[model samples]
Target: MTAKKELLGSLLFAWGANSYGQLGLGHKEDVLLPVRVTQGLASIGNIKCLVGGGGHSAIITDDRTIWTCGSNAFGQLGLPQHLGESTLPLPIKTLNGKAVEIAAGLRHALAVTAEKGLVFQWGVGMKSLANRGLQTLPVPAFMSAREPCEVPGFGHVKVKHVSAGAYHSACITDQGWLFVWGSNKYGQLLSSDDFLPLPFFIQPHHFEGEKITLVRSGWTHIVARTERGQVYTWGRADYGQLGRKIKSTQDSMCKSNVIQSRFTPEKVPELTGASQITCGSEHSLAAVGDSILSWGWNEHGMCGDGTEVNISEPRQISFFRNYIPAAIGTGAGHSMVLCRSAGQSGGDFKACPEEQAVCQGNPETATT
Candidate 1:
């Protein structure tokens, strides 16, 4: 399949498995071809931003509107009640007004808002690493069917951006602080082992010094890019997701559970100048200026090089050197990118007016 995509006049491209019309290509068949997703709803000109998970998709319009399709097993689509699955991008109710950015995980959703000035989550609910329990999540602060508040000390925190791991969550707020919660089994929660709190907000020592620029959460590890162009990682190092090989040196100065398990945030050996970031099921991808870097699992070419060999440490993905990447998105096992262009708009092709607008171009960075 020719998966090369160019940003031109607001166009949307669909490739890979499409069993649920999640590809929005009119049918429920896998798409080995680069088909345009211009359909009944998207034609009105929305051309909003688009993100894809394992088998689901999310689209946000320029007007702060949100739409979702595909699997809803855990209410990841933010629909009123569980709808099972969707064949195409469907408008989500009450999701408008002041949305700045949106992110998706294997079965969860996250968003940053203006008025609320915070991060919100909903979906499969992240499981607890200590208690080993599962709960539904709504984002900025953990939620239930009744209340949604702040993350303890992070009260009324205005989020700058948000990201999600397979079962965890991360965020950077306007206060120049990074807060992580949900699922810390492998220390993906970036906290001490014994200090298990119910979706409590804790700051990582590695995030000190300068303010952060961007943050990306992966399945088991999390990476962040700062204004200084330095990339930092924490959480789950069993697979070398921290971008360096470590001999598993976890020290628990605090917390009683430290005796049983050691969970501590450590810095990646030698990585710098990251311009963009994204994460897959168990691997990671980033751009240092124009250099593409991949780390962690590469079983299915998820590393984006040309090999299936896993990269426990960092490796250069020297595929798109000449092009400067603008944006990035990752699915359960694949990745997508957007390149900056001159007067080019990723064309919109949906059937309805509400779905019409300027759509974010899906980078053909391919599953590699």
Candidate 2:
């Protein structure tokens, strides 16, 4: 019998603000164009996970090893405090086990191990009475070690997937239950402004029977998708990042009046059938069919909709209506998109649609 050989050919590229060299381009130079990242990680096997945060980047390879770069002021890179910052990807040590999944936020990082269903975290976003006097950890720490640790108000549960936000964290349990912790000032934790020192289960029968499949957090907002293809959002909506319009009834006397912000999870309209979702610091993107829909803050043209205005409702970007996006990543002030020709396989990559005539030839790559 002949053995089957696996082939993996994935490329990683990045752009936007490189003030911290988070793009891993070997320099802290910002580029308006996407450049292929090919340093330090050229020898790594297939990339299993690639995520970008405010000023740092992280990736997990098929070999189950974790690599990180950029700002480490709060040890978001999982390296020791004395190591300082890095412009190139470096392996993280002292992890209990091989990392299967990883997530990064503005000032914190989280990783899930393959064996024992363990989760580890580091950085300063997390707050608690025990560490009240301290600021932030310059090294990684255990959130749940060998055995499961019961959350203060919520019962004990094993986490299957997790996401770290700017000042909060979220996780989905093996039972499809969702829990959150950390700063809830903007109600990003789906409750009061009181900071939750421990994980708390979000109550609401709306997600009772649904199997939570995916959850992503922005700087101060969250986007969750279920097994049934339903999307829900909560937290800051000052820039319409929640994909809903604002309705104010109070008088203009309150100039600093708050707009619409969901203290609880609310379903976002027009994103019912999305398959994948990613969030920037204040913007979000979702993939449905062959098109990409984006909304929220776009002051830097991060929405990629050919406009600098903020989007309050989900709208498909006509440029990508024909080309299907394979993956998407976002950072504090930029967006990255990877695409492949829809309905075409192998080497059938072609030029973009005629409407976007500016791109007349088969481009070297597809990214924003």
Candidate 3:
């Protein structure tokens, strides 16, 4: 018998802010409703992964190729030329057979390969050899040392996951340990130093002996989840991105709720049993069973509560009721929710709203 592997669902949809064409809708406009983005991919097996950063979106084909769009301001798109941006999906040829998963930051991207667990990175501050003086590129170059380069200090261990924040990056090892490097401004890397020049293992006081199952970073914050779903958040919280609220001990008339930032990983008492978690510039999204919860900066409705209120408390998005979210993600000012119709055992999607605010590809090609 021929060999077979598990496949991911095919119902890819995007919505919310698209100022930089991060939605890949062929135009720079915000989408208030869900729009299909599975174009030109049915012929190439299943689309396994989707990732969003400050102003970019990416997808990985089941065949292990990468396609990206949106802002290439710092060569994050891995293109041969920095044409500002692309409103349509363009292939990143350099990562073809090399990446198993993609992680992105505000101005950078990381390709995680299982082979020796190598990580190839591009974008701002990625050229740093000693992790000190780094430069940013405004134009895209070929995917070589000038564009994409393998991380030197982390080739010894096998990384199973990778994540990128604004100026820093992180990865989880097969043994469930977390390693990070890059700018530690705001203490996002949990190090007192300014720049990490190289990847270093982080042993958070809160995670004394627990194994980390997943780790994600935002513009200036980082969150890690243990195998049992316990979550710890740290870093910039000026926008309440740490899922924490400040304490006010002033007199009754002078009391005010102050949002504070954290420099150490503190367990968020409200979150548990999260199967998946993702972070935006100042917001966060997590999945628990069929329910999805959000918190932090909601300036542009990235919280998806149909409101633009910055909150530190976790709130559930009722719109996803009765829907089984297969995957959830966040962008700088947007959110992407991929769900399969409830009651369907497979990755089959149900009918979505019919309205052509702006169209790309054949909508008829999406399966229900």
Candidate 4:
């Protein structure tokens, strides 16, 4: 096979502040556009997935190996024991098997391997903690995290998906089980109706069985949409991110505001026929029947809508309604969406629908 086959495609990167060379654009300037990341990885091909942590970033391939660059201050790069910046792409040997998907927090990274279960993380973000130390790749302390610990769960169960947020992480198993961990500052870890005020620095059972088909983690909240298309959310909802209009309910998991804490999952009105969803740092967007609506934070026009610097509740972004987004990715301050124009054709490969979970990453890892 050609080398390109192994590398996926060309590397893609974008950085708002490149002072630490997080954008890998060869210079320490803020990159406003997505550019090629050629510092470390040269032989890789189509990038299966991309994740950002604080200022650093990581990309995984079909080969199962991971390449990371940018920030290492908190070891978000997933490289060896190092601080500073990578300046180039460095290989992560710890994750050898094919990684199906990955997500990033402010200072940590999470990955789900083809092996069966998900791997725990040891780095920064909401989970960062008193040990707020840094490492290049995962160290023994990281792998065996204690408080805000990486506490690898799922036992032997097969994890189907995983997502990371600013201070929290989330996942879904093959059987449709959902899990949450880290930062409870906003009750992001309490998945159930009865939640404690204390946030588990480690993974905790926020909610039980909801038959979730997909789950995505935001900077401070976690969203899971069930197979029947029912969306659930936990964590902070300062901007009505829970989808439900802020009301007088002051119960934990169901309550919001200082009057009552511990908000729970509530149905988002008008978010119907949603095939998929992704979350930005504080806001959220869902692809519903060829339309896109956003809520929560929109401070920098990240929502793609014309104005409204901040979206307190669910709002519509009509700009790209007609374009069908095949896939979507959200960053702390930015978002990436793959819009497959209708009538356009490519390699003999026909794109798969969202239900398949066909396998995330590079074409090398794609299954027929």
Writing each residue's lDDT as its tens digit, candidate 2 over 1-368 gives: 10001112334446566788777778887755445566754355555556677888777765677888788876778777435678888887768787756677787777766665466777654544225423463211343221112233323555666677887778766666777777776767766535666667776475555766677888889988666667888778878788976544556654344434365567886988665577777888777755778899877666776567999899887666655654566676566655544554421112222111111110122110
**lDDT of candidate 2 at residue 269, scale 0 to 100:** 66
Give candidate 2 regions above 4 Å deviation: 1-7, 33-35, 38-43, 127-156, 204-209, 247-261, 306-308, 317-323, 343-368
lDDT for residue 208 in candidate 3, whole number 0-100: 62
> Judged by TM-score, which candidate is best?
3
**Cα lDDT of model 4 by residue, 39-127, tens digit:** 44334545555555556656665565667766777667766565578666666776645676777777777777676565556464433
What TM-score does each of the candidates earn? 0.71, 0.77, 0.82, 0.72
Backbone clash count, each prediction separately: 36, 0, 2, 27
lDDT of 1 at 293: 73
Q: For model 2, where is the 10-residue window of minimal lDDT?
A: 354-363
TM-score of 3: 0.82
lDDT value, residue 4 of candidate 3 = 12
Q: lDDT of all the models against the reference?
A: 0.55, 0.63, 0.68, 0.55
Model 4 scores a TM of 0.72
Q: Write model 1 residue lDDT over 300-343, tens digit each, in one string.
A: 56566767677887777665554445444456655544443323
Ranking by lDDT: 3, 2, 1, 4
For candidate 4, the lDDT comes to 0.55
